[model samples]
Target: MTSAPAARASMDAGRALPPPVLVVSIVSSYLLALHPGTLPRDATTTAVVTSGFAAVGAVVGMLLSRWASRRRPHPDTQTRRVVFGAGVLIAAGGAGLSVWWQSLIRAAVGAPPVGPDWWVAATVAPAAAVAAIVLIPRVTAVIAASAVALAAGLLAPADAGADRGQPSPRTIVVSEFGTLLRGELAAPEFDHPAERLVRSWMHSGGLAARAVIVAVPTGSGWVDQAAVAGFVDRFDGDVRILTLPYADVPSWKAFISDDATATESSITLVRELAKVLANRPAGDRPRLVLYGQSLGAVGADAARVWLEDHHPSLLAETVLTAPPAGTVAQASRTPRIVVANRSDPVVRWSLGSLWRPPAYPDDTVLGGRRVPEVPWLPVVGFLQSSVDLLAALDGPTGVGHRYGTEQARPVSGLPR
Candidate 1:
């Protein structure tokens, strides 16, 4: 079913890349793209500037393709060369259309204009074009597939609207793993999963822990067991965790417009916990802690008002990780800890929340990693944030948008 030339070309293109080359290029490309600040206020003007950058990239890609073909005279190389040229052509057209498209959205919807700094994205146009010409042809397929997926995600119908949302639930989903962590003094005294909770007793032979935690699942509807392993093992005494089940989907897309789903589930969890907290005597009452990660973090944070209004109780603390944009109005008043990696893009897209410099509050903690320092370009940085987001999801924590570093370790508020 394959042609000789096509088969040969596939083999040449699919050769395994060295880890170092792969790591360096990805980091370089992402950092070069992320110089966000002070974008042009006019969306049209920003697009025009971005278009200018694409023109520059076309010329650069052509030159690189010609140079690479001469140095490596092979049919496969020639094919890549052609593909790179085509990519440039497509990119130029797309840039022009993207500007026009944004304009239409503004004209029709009365939405805010795209930021002026977004135009700076054009600066990386040339570099990205050249990389395609000289480096990985494999990435081409990924980009193409992503284009299709984006369309599908955007086209999906909207969920529960602002005025009314889905009804509340009577039962919640609870999961149990024998130990969230292994090693060093984690003994279960009153181990129970049937009540939809997990309780771990201290290794020092304590009867029970004096505190409890109720954590919501991530946007994807499951907990990152490893990330929470430390929380389970850190307590000096018994710690109880109650988790809700909204396992219908594994992505934030599942909850985008569905505020009610998050509100209802979180409300149910809090209400049920309040009943247990109400019954206990003061000395025996476990200190309540609220926790959420990623999408779960946003939902848990936002639902604070409703929880307080209806189930009002003093929570000892709320801990969140990789929380997406918490609008200025959604900012929390309670003492809570937010952990975010400087490289994560989900936080960046929120405009002012996690990673970008001008947006964080004085109390926020940022973990630094090396990023190629390029000139600060707002528009370009905005454009680059999308790429960095992908890389962060697939690449490194502190370096790309991913999280999982020692710096992010659970500290004193949790058990030792």
Candidate 2:
């Protein structure tokens, strides 16, 4: 049993990562991947998250390994066997816990239970763990993995069907800011989108509609089509919903980097619309209503505040669904209906949530449906809510970020 090659291999093994370290890295990461979030995620999302977490867990495990190595220096063969065996047992328990979590996630989100996708995730778990463990020990590998994760996150298709609803088919005048995604294709882009949109609307007889609903789009130029359809119903099919695409980037990216695009676009469109309305006879002018959701809400509120300052009587009403935490205060004029789901992370999450509890409207103010209470736990709540934001669009209609015709309800008789 003590051949030269076997003895040499045993000596070299001390330089390699400990077996228990690998087990800790993998099991801990996999468990967190299966943890419950506010909304359901697809198999791909789960796999990517697992891979990313595996990388983080491997780093954490290495730190623990370094600390233990200093205390023990070298472990006897029997001790190594005992530690590895115990780690395997713990890993087994973690696997069981992951299965239990899968069941809960499925039941909570009405997703299919333990099918082919589950098996795929199970297979990916070990591979991702091995890859992460192998790559994390080197500095270049660490940087490469981080870059890949960031790219994957940015390129990932927007939270599955984040803009699922389509615009109404009922002769609803659809005027777009010409060439919104122009720069995306390396095409020569032009300016004066507001003037272009106004010209198009005037030519399309939008001015003749009974109501003009200016729909400010989210950062990615998405307006909830269902909400637009609701606007048509509220106006008795006599409304023209206007949308101007601002940027082709995701809402989060636009929210942080170029929120000004939304503000500037909204102001331009609303200002142009106001001038057009002023030229018309008072009796012929259509009622102007402002609508936006999420980042679109931020932009619409900017324009709403501007309208209040410059032309207080121009805007009849404003409807904002799931507006961001601080945007409502900026657009604080009356006749504004803000529909925010109690479960929506977008409405509650902010940097300040780490230390301070988020401010929420009273139960009576929320009205109708509401999600179960989540006890705020300072930093923990902030972290959980941030994770929930990724799945914000995954819940049932009327819950989380998704809204329905209920968003069209009038603001009358509600507390300011």
Candidate 3:
């Protein structure tokens, strides 16, 4: 009895998205944004992240709807009643989550709640959900492929013979030191750098120097110039600082995948230097210090452990700045000083931190100086800490993961 146009209309109506899908998407978006991060996000970032969450939520909602539909083919009235019930529950739950987020944010920052940001998320979530449900795998595929292509081009390792075009940030920093010292500091550019650097140091009469500091570089091969400057200041320009290039990737990537590169490279350099150091008398030998920050600290600590086992007397001191949780070795005889900030996510973030509170180094004199304590709340703490890791470096000199020349200060009463 129905006309063709009416039948087409009925089909279109049937294809319309279920009410619970939109509710789930919006709820999911808000839930993710509820977690407090190290840095409070701006409206733009909040919207973008919420939208991403909404898109994922939309897919999940669609699947959930399919399952529910198969389980119970409800009539129109029953569906409306179910939708109303979900909406009411969502409203009440959202209010509770909002209050919790407000309290955490308030505690982190003195005043001015992140209430407005929630609106940004709320406004963006439903629209993002609708778009995701409509433009799904096609749009996702294109974006993913493009992102992969871009990352591949940027991250691909260059051949040694290939012209890298411009020098990297690490090279610039190292080269700048050479220019500043007027060629007194030799940053080796050629192959067999460990042997070449030691040879250069020896040629420059570094063997006769009062002290030598082996500066373990960050994952990206960046040796902190401040730390080097601090060492120079401490030794009164009689210290020969040495470092070698390792991986050229970001610290996190190197931390996860190529951390062994740092440890092994450090060991190789120290071993070569140790062989040369052995030629001199024990009391006349240069005071050897191992210095590392962040990922560098992880490597340097591991090397320190190795040195303790093999060449114990060669290393005078080990300085580990902001080393990550669970990475420090327990069995080292060398005088080790760990400089960690109270609020440093790097020092606190581990698998165990998900449940148990992080334990600070009892031996560290410089640990936990500033910042109010961030209360730990089971799963919430883990989520916040995970987010905090991204912005750990954004804080001031003494806060979070940012350490200063103070990190290079010699431990009190330690023989330098």
Candidate 4:
């Protein structure tokens, strides 16, 4: 008789477990349907939707726990086990569905599908479920159920959205030193075939005129698609922008030593550019300008020196924007301009050595009487607006080291 009661109790417990699992799975599925786009592009939309799900889960969990608590309990070990197994299956199913949805979205957008990583969603769900089961008994299963419901609401959908497809941003690869070498040799070409602005710009200018504008990317890795197109469209003269491949070159003896193989590779690039610039006819000899941001500034500075020493007349100007940690000295006999912004955090860290008051006094004359403190966002936005390089030249003024705005002017009386 006891065995019969135990069997009946187990069956009852088993029946109880499915409701929670079904609730969680349904919630997860619903969230997976709403794909929030990637960061910066759809940040606001993602945040709003995520918050909404969290709120709804909290209310539903509370109500479900209250209803479950009032029901008569049965001691059914077999039923409990069955329910637990079912919950696990539901969790696994939800995760699988999320992965499939993400893959489909990526395929639709021409992005590489993300493969199943052990680290993604599989680990979190089980742990959360176990926590809910353990806590519910001690604190009135109603409260525990509510907590689990809320957690499920927040995490299940958030995970689904996190799995949303991301289209790979276009990338251009070139060596650190290879960029200068390319500039020295042939005029740069747009790497991406889809860039309409670059094609249009090239069509407008004849071959000779198009050769003057040199495109210098700032950091390592793939270049930004919008930035590349924007530069091409906004350039007043003939422009050639080269996208360098991503390579890590730390500022250490291993990388920068004169005898280092990497150093040699860098120098070879400069030599190539010098040879190219040297061969051009006087009428066709374009004024070389080095434009670089961040670490690219260092490469540009080095290339400028190499060109001036070997082919002095080729260099017209050097523009260093948000250069890495280094003193900006004369890269060549030609004129050099440094554009810094006040609001850039990275630039501030870089400017620590460069912005000494005693050695590198602020040039008040060039900055005008009132210093400008343009925010980083506006400056970056302005750059993105396809403004002419000449218009982009004037930024904000302050002691801060920013990229887009005119922060601090170079010390006056320095020879151009």
Candidate 5:
């Protein structure tokens, strides 16, 4: 029979092997799932691929566990060390292969590559290292080193298809503000005042002849900067763009409290915008066009409501991209467009309910119990890509819920 120390050593060697195998299996499973070719072309295909990955992971994990338990004891420490070192190498190789494969897959799919998140790798590495130490006999040092190397590689920042080239025109001016002002002015495109006035008043009220674009900065404010530049480049008009800072809700709470003032700053900015437009000459009769994303979307919606209630004749169009929860319905009636992405994890959370129940009239809600189909997916994708390009220019985390290189398309006829 094998002695206690011999058996213990054997068990450790076996343990080391299983961890590498587990890492390989996990990385393989994720890559398989992410392969563009396997992505569900239809609802049925998606369900199949998702289920397949889950099942494979479960089966592989079980098998690895059983295999690791069956190894026999060996008295040679060098042999055990060799086996442990091999396992570490295998695990690191598997991780490296996974990353390389994913990059290739992304390129093949014509989609942007998945950039590395150091934070995620940092959290994953230590667990992997511990597993290596416990499983491999006499090879704990090698396993730890391999784990660190793998983690470092995985966590290293990568190019996310962001360097397509510099923007042709680097700045934009968003001019329409309040309810009656209508028009957009960009670096490359200039809006005709008469045409803008007609378009601004075409919908709800005939009183306002022009609209102003209000830029409300949220979070880091990079989005506001990029959006203004993009608008100026693409839009052909003389619309005015006003830059406004995010408002603090606590300060505004003393004035208005019945409603949750989560986006009080945005509301305050819109209210101030109306006052500014009112002071303009008669020809500049103010109409409003609001553009907001993520948290700013929520603020823009509140501002839209405030505009409609106070200056009914001045309301125009509202475009919200990837807005947070509780902001969709605010743009329901007016010429409103919402852009959302299916792959975006954050947007996925809010996809369940675009509008809250009770207040959502039966006619306005689409698809009944299931979430309504977002009519602006294409636009969202374009805007997302544009934001990505902008991020590359600015050298920051532009992929996360911000304005990027994605172009915003017109969604005029789609059902909300």
Candidate 6:
């Protein structure tokens, strides 16, 4: 029979190993990073791939844990308890440090500091880390390898389809109907994006458009072209979409400064348009509407504007999809629609940010349930929210932030 020390040492060695799920996650992530062929190399691809890694890691973890349980049952020991305690502390410390780091970064940039979302990340990440440390025996080598592989994935060059050769935003406008509808590019003539949108609106000044939509784009300058197409089709092509553009940051990873710039530009565009449309006959006036998603939605929330006399000509119906639950905006005089999916972290990470059972003139669709004030429960959802954000990209639940063709269909009884 093995001696007590020998058996203990063997069990300890097994406990120290990195979880097989984590090992697979890192490897799969690296492989995906290497093989996203022909897809526009952008943040969406990264989000989708990263989430896939997390999902696989989760599944493998559950299966392995169950199998290990059936092999032998080890009695709880003082040493094991100590190890688990240390891990929990370490995880908590790491999460706290990350939150502090994020705060410093935001302050340095002069942006609104992070809200409850950071707290959620702080709680969730540490718990996850501790779970790995506790469940996987002899995890050092696997952890190091996984880290290295992930680093490789992040550092890899991801530009695909030679996107530099693509057309400018100004050239991508939809002149009439029965043409390309994916509105992705910004108007070219000027360096400032909002100016381009204003000019585009002027170019269509002659049309008797029944409605106009001023859209604020996400960090990547994507205003959901397919969504735009759906919006325009719903309006019977009598509408002109003025997409207010700012810097085309790679993804939602763009700075809060970029968000501020976009918000300011959106405000400028809407104000100018409102000025021009102020004098049109009541029957001939085009209904002004605003659409934004993710970062764009946040910017729209910030651009909350009204005329000197509280006129509603410039701003009418507004649609905000997956807005950050942090910042608060005043209620709009007109119909305000907030669309969100419980699966998206960006929309649910901040406690009290997403208006549960949306009130008043503001109507909200199913984004997520309200965050429980309980200690780490909110944080738990926040972690899942992070992964769900990537899941949102593919509309895995068919009701995520992307909203696809069903985008316009959600706002029932509203004008197109």
Ranking by TM-score: 3, 2, 6, 1, 5, 4
Candidate 6, residues 1-416, lDDT tens digits: the string is 99999989988875665444334443333233222111111234333443344434444555665676678564245444555455445445544554454455334323356566445443444335434544573473386469779988887332111113323363446545522222334423223444445555656552367677777776555666565777777777677777655555443444344457666656766776666687777677777777777777766655555432345555667778767665436465566777765434455555442233222224666543221121233334344344444434433223334355455543557645
What is the lDDT, from 0 to 100, of the residue 184 in candidate 2?
A: 17
lDDT (Cα, tens digit) per residue for candidate 5, span 1-416: 99999999877766444344444554455334333321112233223333344335434754674576477442245544555466556545644654554455344334355455422342244344344433462486565468669978885332222212312122332234332232222211222322343344334343343335654434323234455545444343324444333322321131133223325555655665565465656555644567766555666667777777786555566666655434456435556666543323233333333332212211121110111122334233333223222222122223233344232333366221
- Over 1-416, each residue of candidate 4 has an lDDT whose tens digit, in order, gives 56988978766756655455334543453343232211111223322333334234434644564677578564245655665576557546655654555455344434455543321323343344334543463454576469679978775211100012321123322224222112111112322321332333334342345334333433222232333343344444235554332232222222233212222233344454455567777667544555555455556566667667777777666656555334345333666665543322323333232333112112211221222232323223332122111122222322222232231122235321
* Model 5 lDDT on a 0 to 1 scale: 0.42
- Residue lDDT tens for model 1, 1-416: 99999978776664332222232333333333223321112433343334334334433544554565577653444444555455446545554554455454344324365554444454354445445534654575476468669978786432211111222223432236422211111112111221233212223222245555666665334555544554655554256555554434434465554535554565555655565566666666666667666666655665555555664554666666666645212345555667666655555565432334335433346663533233434555556554344334433334433455232245335533
Candidate 4 lDDT trough over 10 residues, lowest sum: 157-166
Evaluate all candidate structures by whole-model CA lDDT and list the values in order: 0.47, 0.66, 0.65, 0.39, 0.42, 0.52
Choose the strongest candidate by lDDT: 2
TM-score pick, better of 1 and 6:
6
- Candidate 2 vs candidate 5: the lDDT winner is 2
Q: Which stretches in model 4 have alpha-carbon errors above 4 Å?
A: 1-207, 213-216, 222-237, 246-267, 330-332, 348-416
Q: Looking at candidate 1, what is the lDDT of residue 416? A: 36
CA RMSD for every model? 17.5, 7.0, 7.1, 18.0, 13.5, 13.7
TM-scores of the models, in the order given: 0.51, 0.68, 0.70, 0.36, 0.43, 0.56
Q: On TM-score, who's better, 2 or 3?
A: 3
User: Which of candidates 4 and 6 is the stronger one according to lDDT?
Assistant: 6
lDDT score at residue 151, model 6, on the 0-100 scale? 81
Report how far off residue 47 is in candidate 2 (Å): 3.2
